[model samples]
Target: MFKTFVASALLISCASAISSFDSYKKSQKSNFTQEKSQFSDYKKAQQKAFSSYIKELEKYWKKPIMTSKKKLVSYAKDKKSRTIIDFGHNRLTIETLAKETQEAEQKLSLALVQAVTFNTEDFYNNDEFEQQLAKIEASHKIATPKIDAEPVLAPIFFKEQPTKKSLYHFVKHNITPEKIQIQKSSKIKTDKVYTLTISLPKDATIKRSFIYYEDVKREATRQQIPLALVFAIIHSESSFNPMARSYVPAYGLMQIVPRTAGIDAYYHLYKKKRLVGSSYLYNSKNNIKMGSAYLHVLYYKYLHHIKNPTSRLYCTIAAYNTGAGNVARAFVGTNDTYRAAQMINRLTPEEVYTRLLKDLRYSEAKRYLMKVRKRMKLYKKIYES
Candidate 1:
């Protein structure tokens, strides 16, 4: 009976694999046929749509400015003699004005469709579709297995003085050593042990800190991220300076670029459009809120496959400094083009950390990761203590 059951399971698995492969082949054939059939018509449609849209936009812009005098004169005249100023300054009946507006709006809708469908071939050229297909194939190649819990990182020890040994340990473990403090031994005896402290910059102290503690804590809690991690990021980015601005023109404590990460987080979290000419990021509360929200997106959205909390935090921190694309590149090997999340799912936490440290392209990004990690430890020690 046992042999029969095992044999039946093996046959089922084989059938499923074969079915999946056939489905993939059918999808490929369909995509190819659709592309070939639509190629010429797609270009012609795009050109026609854009030309119509431009004509409508010109009409909209050239709409006549109806002066008060003209309105009064028109109103005084009989319906047959009276003429409303239509678009392009042409005198016409009110019905014509309404008709033109409706036509223009319709043309605008067609233009949008053209814009979206323009250069459909370019989409396939990027190989993203192929990569996604590959990922799906890989997923089906194996059955789902139980996931093991990640191992906890050991506590880091900071000595009284900065030594080569301590520095080496910090680098090996990917910790940032921001500040070192040496304390005199309190003991009167000739042989006494002294305490060495690893601290953040003086600007990070509460007295000089620009971030509102309550707001950061609240936002971090809302995002389900650690408060220490938020604090450390702000410390590394701007050293808690609310007015800080980076060379990239990233503003406020978290140094967010208003157009990129800021807008992305704003739309994702608030479910609203970010308007132009807004300077909300300069406000400490708003900056921390947006920055924290962006970090949340990076961790849970982009690096979601990294199961270990520590590994995810590290990759998210790196992504914050650099772009998420760069972080993904580090994971799949610099030379490889696999999607970051898909590749990350196949590796251990330690492997992810090691690859990030060694394979990241930019030296600055590598340093940024180290600094953020180091500051995180310091902030955790000070605030959580």
Candidate 2:
């Protein structure tokens, strides 16, 4: 549950959290109504389609189909090799049953080949599938899609032979116990449960970062933040996992929580208080933009009062993981931001960094600050020229 930055940023203490987002939205309804939403029609249609997708899920509830966001690619995992039999007494009932033969390899291979060209574009906004299925393919070096659900330069599944592995191995690190069970029972003939885990070239770190560099460069520069810093944040947050999520329920590339970071970033950009949903945040372009804007808010707004520029950055970085209040307490023993800045002005940048590393309340925040800082240098040395 990392990247609770904005949720923690505005609060004075854990006892006093952000006011109910509903209350905030009601107050800003006038300004919100004035803003033209570009995706209203599309989201409406998507909502209708989701109703159908949910019904479709009833047919595969026991062996739910996990898939890439839109490219329709999938990493098919089955447990016939291990737990082939169990309590049929608590049997999962579905609207339909698997038409695939009882043969495990045939069941797996057929679904794999069919998924090679299948696109889940219609079901891209399906959160249940997105969370469990895991996003495997990221778009190539292209413009972020104009439509939130569309993918730009998305390679067809199984098209690239550069890198791949079995689905079981690829997902072991990220899968939940429930997901593990679903993978075992999946044998639906037409469900497009692919076995081959199609992935981008992870042979080099740059290869992964390059996939989203165009968008990162644009947003970082537009926000007047360092390009390397943004790159480093993405690197540290999810290791370039586009579908990354945290139990904090943060979503997409930056692990942005809709209620907190998303709301803050949207308000900063549009001057309207609104709750951004996971579907919108799942779009890599939107995620990076919001994350960069959040970072901009941290540096230029929350931590802006510190006299030393470098000191401001260290605090900003720490505050990006913890909160401005936490960082404030680290220096001044009180959660008063203005007082913290006053104390920070009296010390050198080194003093500020040392204090954060040594005294920040959360170990995660200290480690997070160090990781992002180190990755910033790595990104600078290797990619920034």
Candidate 3:
């Protein structure tokens, strides 16, 4: 009877253990199913959001076609608004407006290029030449001597007799012309006014429209970036104005924020010990160089694992406007700080781009990417042509 009781106890214990194991497995399966459902819902929401955004953007691009006269008048009153409206007025479509703007921009760019490229000899004339000579004289402290008296003859005594000598007396009286020294007045030092004439190949209005083409190209080449991409960035950033300053207090054509991207690029590429200040970015070349280098760093250092070149380029462009940290967050679908290398291993380039478009926190970054990509095509077309 005791033996029978032991067998029964062992069977009960084994039965309870199997039951617990089955319950654990069911709980695990239920949790996985719930997680899968949540992920599916999240993906659907993301798709919806992306779709709505694209539709809204399409509406904006198609805006001019349906723009009312009242709206045009309202836009026309503001100088800044009028320029955009005027470009679209004739085209009656966004494409035409873009083309019109591109053409106008190209004309202005060409005029500027010609102005900087043409030799200054064409502007040289007697008046300009004389002015330059005067400048040189003033700079060197050169002055002409003033002659106060005419040549005069004086009487000289030879032995015992006093005799009158003509002006030629220099030879007869042993008086040398060198002995009669002309008095030279001290140089009349005047404030030197430097006048520089910049002759534009076209009107001043057009020349002012495009000032920093060469600097953009030079820095773009030095950074090994596409010239069109640089131009697109400048077009989006500050429209190629070297003196541009943003509300963030970013400076120059590429709109560099010296404390952040500027310092990062300076240290990364230049390997400098000290950080360059904001004033340095006010220079057009410095701004472009730093901005482009920063973009390159984002592409290679942060987004390097993205296999698709175009996708990588787009992300890099967005990162330039936003920040790489935000980009990494978008990639991993997490707001929490995470490593890009770890996340990149799990995602394809297209997946990264889609995730960025759907998940990026900033609307401005989204708009920036679209505008830059659109403008890049325009720049390449206009530039090559």
Could you tell me how far off, in angstroms, the CA of residue 369 lies in candidate 1 after the best superposition? 0.7
Please report, in order, the local distance difference test score of every candidate based on alpha carbons.
0.52, 0.59, 0.49
Q: What is the lDDT of residue 147 in candidate 3?
A: 16
Position 234, candidate 2: lDDT: 80
lDDT of 2 by residue, 1-385 (tens): 3458766754645334345555566656755444224224333444555466556654545543422221122222332221110011211111112333334344443443333222224234334434322221111111123224332122422234323454333333323233221233444445432222223333334555766788999999999998999888887776654655464657667778766677779888887666555556667888999999999998998888987888998898888788789999998898899999998999999988999999999999999999998889988987679
| TM-score: model 1 vs. ground truth | 0.46
Q: Please report how far candidate 3 places residue 208 from its true position, in Å.
A: 6.7
TM-score, one value per model: 0.46, 0.60, 0.44
Q: Residue 281 deviation, candidate 2, in Å?
A: 0.4
Q: Which of the two candidates, 1 or 3, achieves a greater TM-score against the reference?
A: 1
> Stretches of candidate 3 above 4 Å error?
1-210, 334-351
TM-score of 3: 0.44
Query: Which residue pairs show collisions in model 3?
Result: none
**lDDT, residue 170, candidate 3:** 20
What is the alpha-carbon lDDT for the whole of candidate 1? 0.52
Off by over 4 Å in 2: 1-102, 107-205
| Candidate 3, backbone clash total | 0
